[model samples]
Target: MRFPFTALPLLALAACTTGPDYRGPETARPATPGAQFARASGDTGPQAPAAAAWWTALNDPVLDTLETRALAANPGVAAAEARMRQARASLRSERANALPSTNASALYVHATVPGLDLNDSGDSDQSGGGSESLNFYNLGFDASWEADLWGGKRRGVEAARAQLDAAQADVADAQVSLTAEIAQAYVHLRDRQQRIALARDALARQREMLRLTEQRHAQGTASALDVERQRHLAEQADAALPPLAAERDGYLNALATLAGEAPGALDGMLAAPSKAIVPLPPAQVAVGDPAELLKRRPDVRAAERRFAAATAKIGVAEAARFPSISFMGLIGIGGTSPGDLVDFDKLAAIAMPRLSWSFLDFGRNAARVGQAEGARDEAAAHYRQAVLDALRDGEDALSRFGNGRLSVASAARSKASADRTAALTRQRFEAGAATRIQLLDAERQSLSAAQSLSQATAAMTADYIALQKALGLGWR
Candidate 1:
């Protein structure tokens, strides 16, 4: 059935409510020319996503499995999903009023009458009594729906829909964050494992050098001070090993926890050796566009929806101050017995329209409207801030990732040069061509350079993870 034309004006007015409209804030695009990474070929303003499973580029089966498990069982992910479910339920509740509601009922009544005789007095005896029972049955349907004359219901529905959208965006944000975190932890764990190996190897080399120095000293070819120095170096290297091992264990435990597994459960999976390599896409990452990012990023989308919800709330608060019109109806049949109750002659129906007003709650209603407006303003500010933050994050990540790559390469070269120096120094010492002091210095240099490389590699991998996160994109 069609609504009366007179009701159409109310809906049109509701569609024109004075509330803030959400639109993304202004943003700057990435530099077209000077960006560190080259844009992908056939790229428009923004690059198309490079690869869906970016982690696969690392070629690690264990990491892939861990990522999948984390997505499924991570506490944060579960919380996000629950929030989405709640939003969905709330949306359903809000829409329920858009349609009419119906109800049914039944009842019974009984009574007795007592009487005394008067004429029997002459006859010297008399008595009388009467009893009756009545049963009523009512089977009927009654429905009433608000005209939504001012679009209040529609606006409320709009707000609920926006909230649902925001909840979904939150889930996406949580997923993206989880993936980045897992990758970062995995990289750190691998770096620590490599460091542990380096420490052990350094300790072995130090012991061998100390043994040679002691042998030379025994033959009176080396000074006691030189032998003592070698022993001290070996002890220092040995001391470093335990800490590296501890760190490696800590990272492993962290990864296990993040993957929703008990600590040490992942030990077997990660028990195998691994290396920390900064997994940059074999090609440049395609960051679509700065404007596109505002739309694509879940946080940004969530913020926008929040702003819309806040705007709608203002209408809800405003609608409260006006008369709330409702239609009510009742229909039923009743008689002394069940068969008579169904008689068409006893059936009846009644309908009425009711209007309610909160005559004494002006202060409370005004305060609610004011509160909604304030909330809308706050949401607007937050939305703008979120947009700015996204741009800054992307730019910072790209800058760091670019520089970090160079730093890793330099550190690796330094480590290799130090290794060569240490090896030659040892050979020379063995042939009596180099002093013990020189050989000790070469070993220290090699160890220091190796440590620097390990640190740089870790930093590089971390920056890559940060870049992906900032881009608001990652493996699903």
Candidate 2:
């Protein structure tokens, strides 16, 4: 307190430190997240502004439950949280280092003189036993404090605080990725379910066609090869199911892992049916410009904090190059008996002021400063790259999402046309206006259209998830 000096206090100057103060990088700030994303608005059905829990837009309670559970219990999230706590503890330790510390200790001593012994008058006795003894007890508190004259301790605290901030951002980053993974896996699982069902339906229809073809072959209108071909088509449809079923199970297992459970633990919940609604993102998403994106993205924030920490470390190294000042004070009372240990009037006090300088070791200290500067520069580069990356991700996600919506519409149209064609072809075959080959070809077209639609829908849903992740909309 009060600069740790009293005599010649007027001669002592205020703490002056040498180091480059960090004013963030001198770069052109990008426009605030654009008023609207380049690919947002107009074509993506009814668009609405995104909320923090973007997955809730899907209107799937199952996904909501999954996201909640994953955020609450996922191992990744827990690990991130643990790291944050550690950073905070480190920061606290660093801050505490700037304060004074005191410790109490007790000392007892007994000694015998070589050729003398003390009598009633404390005089030395010689010749008989020729022994002298002394006993004393001492108890005291020792206190010491280092003056932060060069701000080295302060810089260390600053760095620790920034590190804590970085850890916080890391947790947010984990949540963002975890939520996105859950959404993507959930969408894929739903898509596979729909595809598998369609495949099964197609197989049943092909079986019927095969039976009819056999009847026709017996009646002499269909050849053996035609019946054989129908049988082959049925088998192909049957073959499609296995891969889809495998993929569905894979997604379910992934979901279980995301929720921090063993694989297949979520099977009971997911087994009910793949009715998960993979909703498209709103037509007009409000992703603020590049500035907003940079701040919102946890990785970017983490990078920025790392840069701050590095900058503060430069001050730490620079401070180390200067002289250090420390003060120690001790108070103690001692007597021949332990009962006199608490006598204040007899207490002895000592104070020490230490000044240390490594001025002779300037080269080594300079090298350390150089290392800190290099690390700061590296951290600055990382922060800049993080900003660039955030912008790139947001732009890319928006582009994919917008384009995916258009693709979904086209696929839906193709499926509707296929359905109509299959219906008309069936009626014509029944009336003898179309051959069995024509009906079968129409059914194949319908199957292809259904597959395309399912894929397009899944892609659109995935696009939404990606965009939300890029925007950092969830895990708020």
Candidate 3:
């Protein structure tokens, strides 16, 4: 009987595949707008920084170099990229299952029987022990295809595609995080350097005051006790420098490591005074609605994809419970002699359509479906949590940016007032009108104000960096 190839297409068209249709979960809608951290100032509509290279907006050449190096060398980012490639391969493999498969096989064999035949009958057949050579070769094609009578294969492919997309998002997320971390480290290192310089300056100024008090004592215009107090203040100021220097060194080491170098490797680059302020990108940070974040954030998207995969697995298990039908066929010629392999007498051809359904194992299929559903629920929960975190970080970063600017402003005024008060107190002491204790108090107040100003400046820089990270705008 000849089965025409054209019949296959007609059969496929006549068959109906069964399986659950996939529709993305509707839970992806955005969270409320009011009081959400993603909301920017004014309703001009939430704005993200330009999609092109967010780090470039800072306008720092050094930053550009560091970010480039980190993205290339960071282990976490590299691993994420590798995983994405694997996910894509998996998706492709799943999709390929939706089509028919053809396999070609060839076999060759030689054997000898030295004993009687091993069949049992009322009269046993016996043959004299003899050496005989048997050689046969067969070349055939076998094909098997499950009529996707249900959307099982299609659903599986859909789930895999979603997972592959999620993996790509994860890679993006890793890149975003790496850039933010590099920026944060660089800014902190610069601030430490500035603070170290400020501490040294304070020590020098105190030493000058001490020298002047000694001269007054020598001229009998100031008491010996006043000179001793001034000396003590100078010593206190000098003592603070070593600890600040130690902290500066610690930050330097950290920065070097982040740039993918051995500790102290980047000291040469940072040794020069880096007083040039790192530019802040934008005064305002915008967070689109939480719903938008689900689409934008890679981790959340990855979780959603995992959920979709698990949902499809449930249908896969359900399909396993139904009868599986497949078509198989082989055509070839075989003979004891190699030259006779193609003889008409030795030709053989077979075609089969097999249907298999397990009469037992009812509990196994049900258990598999249960497992898939449970996994899906877990993935959904993780996705929800990711959204909440993104919103929280965005809101928190904006608040810090605003409050940090205020802190720096107030600190500046305090430093200025303390400076003026110190100058006047010193003049009074030189005229012998102010007590030694009063002069000492003014010096301490001046030092305190200077430290406060340094702290505020560092805070302001850090807040801006944080705001950008929270808005998910710095990793483009």
Candidate 4:
């Protein structure tokens, strides 16, 4: 059959699309894509960060295990994945809208007419002689398709696809955040445990010093005030234990929860204090330039995708302003007798072409188009802001990581000096050249220095995790 002349132009315009096309976010693109981060100096090398499991860089097996488990089971990550699946389903639904829909139906009707004569043929006067029973059967198919003359459905599909991309990016962003949080909590747990152990050791030594001071007093060489001073030092050391223990337990519980386990599930594995200190990240870290950061950051990518989706929605809104054309068809076979329903000669069909327009709605379509444009602009602004934030995050993380390295080094040097002083003091005391109280004071300074070192090391590792997160290196 030949196509209708009136529908020729509609088919010709079917390939035409409405509204603006998205080429990339112009506002969000960096002018200097090759610029280096200002803080990427000294300890941070000017190299692209590895896309591997960043937590494994610490070489702590427990941390690696926790990160793997958290990524697999974390509720936040699971929710993001679910949203991604939902977006994918929406995209599929939108694509299906562009195709024709068909439905099959089988209908049977039975009716009884009183005061109707079946044996009277066409004679109307004999109709009340008897009642007639009738049975009708129909087997039919119905199909309808709304032509995408202005590409509205196509635009909808485009928007849905971009939304799916955004959802996938959200999942990646969640993984990055979860990994960083788990690493931070683990570092904190180890830091607290180390501090507690140092405090306990210091308390034991202080108690021993108190006993020595009491003996000296009984030998008529030391004053009662000296014994009281030693006891006060020992008590102070003992008083510092509980808070550290509490903090250690808090971090342990946090790790367990992050791994999708109960609060105390990890207690058996992490509750015991270890003599080992918090592991330090490498001295030099690889931080790429700002250009790479924007591309790698999941939040930035998600924002860009949302902007694209919004841009496509403008097309959808613009297409809504035009008239819509649709075609519907029905094909059926029906007969009063059961055998007649199967006869090909008894078939009936209908074809309907429809047109609908909202041209009389005043400015409603215009207002909808305006609203869509406004949303597009808002998304563009958000995309630009996301780019800025990603850059700032990378720079800030780089600065902190660099400074953290210095802080750790300073603490380590202080610890070494304190240790040397304490060793010399102990020797002097053994040689009868220095007093017992002098050795105790030197040992206390050493313990304090060790604690400071532990804190600095943990902070440095935490900063490293932040830097990895900024680079978006934790997710596959």
Candidate 5:
């Protein structure tokens, strides 16, 4: 009764937490034109908001298949998932520490003695008393519970739970990065294929010009210098093909690896050039503001979770300054005969309560508290940095995506103008109203314009993917 009364005060204090409680910081988007964006808004596309699987917007079946494969099998994503599982397991273990534990055991012993008291056992023989051994048996359970009077165990659970959240966020972050990289590689692949096709068309035109120049020079209608320059120009245009083909191959191999396949596995699918230019998103991208980004970005969430973990650790450290209480109990039965253990009347039991304090550690405990405080400060700084970084990435992605649309538009206009010019020059040359040089120059301009258009279109696609990555899409 006295023990129960004395423990009442400790139970009441168990609800007290010693360290500073955590409060989430306020970090809203900066107020400006378009609110969260610094350069422009709606970089994620005009028609629809960016979906979790943003790659679907490309409308390329091959790209869709590849994105699905990469997300499912990418090594980075798998590793992050494994880490999340590990963190969850750790949390379970930490939570277990706050509960009572019990263990069961059985022991049997026999010993020989030169002069033993055999009269204590009825089974001992009088003639064999000098060499007889007494048999003893014990079977019982022991239990101990460390009362969470100072909340140390609870704080450990809190920290572990925060770490688990961080790990889950890490998995989402990995998915975002992996999917974006695959999309970028796929876009570059198609771009090279289209460039190669454009260059091949230009080579054919250049060859035709070379043949016409040679024919005119033989009739003294064109100079030998013109024939030589045309031949050199044709060879130079042809020279650009191999590097683009090689780049295409590289992207194919990279995509295969990202999809967890061997190199060259996707070659059969991508070796042939695409029949048309890869598609690009329409004019307006639907991007969220920076304020929304803080909530969506996995890395930002991970940073905040780590900060929470650090805060909990501070409480765990502070708890060491107080006393610890534990209740221990044991029950067993032992005798010279094993049958005696089955009799409850012969059982022995003990219940002991203990209280301990590290008051003599002097400044050792205080130093631990200081270490925890420093860790909390460091984590808070990281959380701030994460917010700033997310904002910067969002702003940069929007700028590039918005500007990419402009570049593509300009390239399209240039290609259109060059096409009109080339067609007019060919018609004039056929009517004998323009020189062969003018027609060849016009053809060259058209080809160059076409290449620029292809590259710009590819850039737009790449920029959109980067925006999705910055917004932490594709991991849902």
Candidate 6:
């Protein structure tokens, strides 16, 4: 067979790609790379964040277990994982598009005709009606392949791979959010439980004061106003208990749902306070730098991947503006008799090479390319926004955590002062120097201070969880 000289240039240009290549997005960067976060205070250190499971740093066994369960069983995480699998399958399909596809077929036909003779000789001809039967059999293999002359199929595969990467990043993002939510709920639950316990203790003291006031009034020493006031204070304390209990239950149910269980499934395990106080985060948090934050944040990574995918799709669209080359082939063997089906002499083969171009679509392909470019621009903007958002999140979490630490410290000072005053009043009351009402009021102030401290600590822990999530430290 002689080679076709006219096909030389087409073969040479087959390796050429039509559209621009991806070199990573220019906008996917923090405003100040390698700079320490502006909102980080003395409480945070400029060190690379710890390993993926940052929750274990809190040193709470129950929290560690909850994180594990949420990551393993949460429906949101599972859904993200399923999407990743789907992207992978799509990538595989796109890769297969670059190769040829083949199919095999078989056919059989039988017919009978009247007034037709099955055998006829020139020496003998009959006018009488006769029936003739016929049978046909065929087997064939057909194959076709579209050549990637302008790299459209290759770009499609590239886009698919990028989409798979984005999907994987999405799964990681889900994990980050899940772990943070579980940790925050656990903190809130413990905080509410502690507050309830404190309120109950204060209520008992208030009731005792109320009883003492009533006795004093009956003895003609305390006024009726004093007794009523004591009762009102006791009632207020009692009323506070139900709301705290309700909030505690709400957090418990949230945690259970986060672990992929029913609302009350974790009640037995978490209803009671595990510790005397909510767990506090470490003193010095490792926040790394802005550059590292951008790299670690899954949302940023996912957005960048999507941008890359969009860029590849531009190439796919641009390739459509050019001609496409394809080839088809068929081979078969068949005969009238069953033995003839295997006969090489009855074999047939055909090869067809085709070129198709949509140059006269009145700028439809150009519009498609323009649309792809617009999409690419949108994805780039989204990626840039994602980067900025991640930076802001990290900074905001750091700021909240720093301020939370200050609030906790102030609350601690207030609690210490209240405790000292209460102790002095108790001493004075035992020595018969201070009134009973004075001592009870002192104790109430102390309890209020304790409640404030608990709330501040829980808020600080929540801020810590947010910081870790912003750092993308909850997934491998």
User: Scored by CA lDDT, what does every candidate get?
Assistant: 0.75, 0.83, 0.71, 0.89, 0.85, 0.89
Candidate 2 residue-wise lDDT, 345-383, digit = tens: 788899999999999984999999999999999999998
Q: Tell me how far candidate 4 lies from the true structure as C-alpha RMSD in angstroms.
A: 2.6
Q: Which stretches of candidate 5 lie over 4 Å from their true place?
A: 1-5, 28-34, 41-51, 111-134, 271-274, 435-441
Better of 1 and 4 by TM-score: 4
- lDDT of predicted model 1: 0.75
Of the two candidates 1 and 3, the one with more favorable lDDT, higher being better, is 1
Better of 3 and 5 by lDDT: 5
The TM-score obtained by model 4 is 0.93
What TM-score goes with each of the models?
A: 0.83, 0.90, 0.81, 0.93, 0.91, 0.93
Candidate 5 backbone overlaps, count: 8
lDDT (tens digit, per residue) of candidate 3 on 134-214: 567876777778866555777678778878878887887887777777777777666666666666666776777788788
Runs in model 3 deviating more than 4 A are: 1-22, 31-45, 113-133, 211-236, 274-278, 341-347, 416-451
For model 4, state the Cα shift of residue 335 in Å: 2.0
lDDT: worst 10-residue window of model 5: 42-51
lDDT of 1 by residue, 367-414 (tens): 998999999889889988888898788778767877877898899899
| Residue-wise C-alpha lDDT for candidate 4, range 1-476, written one tens digit per residue | 98589877877899899989899977555687777888887677778887659888898888898998999999999999999999999999999999999999998998877787765363334436676777899999999999999989999999999999999999999999999999999999999998988888888789989998999999999999999998888888888998998898889899999999999998887765548569789767888788778888899999999999999999999999999989999999989878877898999999999999999999999999999999999999999999888888888998898888889999999999999999999999999999877898799889999999999999999999999998887877
Q: Candidate 5: RMSD over Cα atoms? A: 3.3
Q: For model 6, how does the per-residue alpha-carbon lDDT over 439-461 read when each residue is reduced to its tens digit?
A: 98899889988999999999999
lDDT of 5 by residue, 242-353 (tens): 9998898899899999999999988887665547567687555676666667878899999999999999999999999988988999999877787988877888999999
TM-score of candidate 1 against the unseen true structure = 0.83
- RMSD in Å for model 1: 5.4
Cα TM-score of candidate 6: 0.93
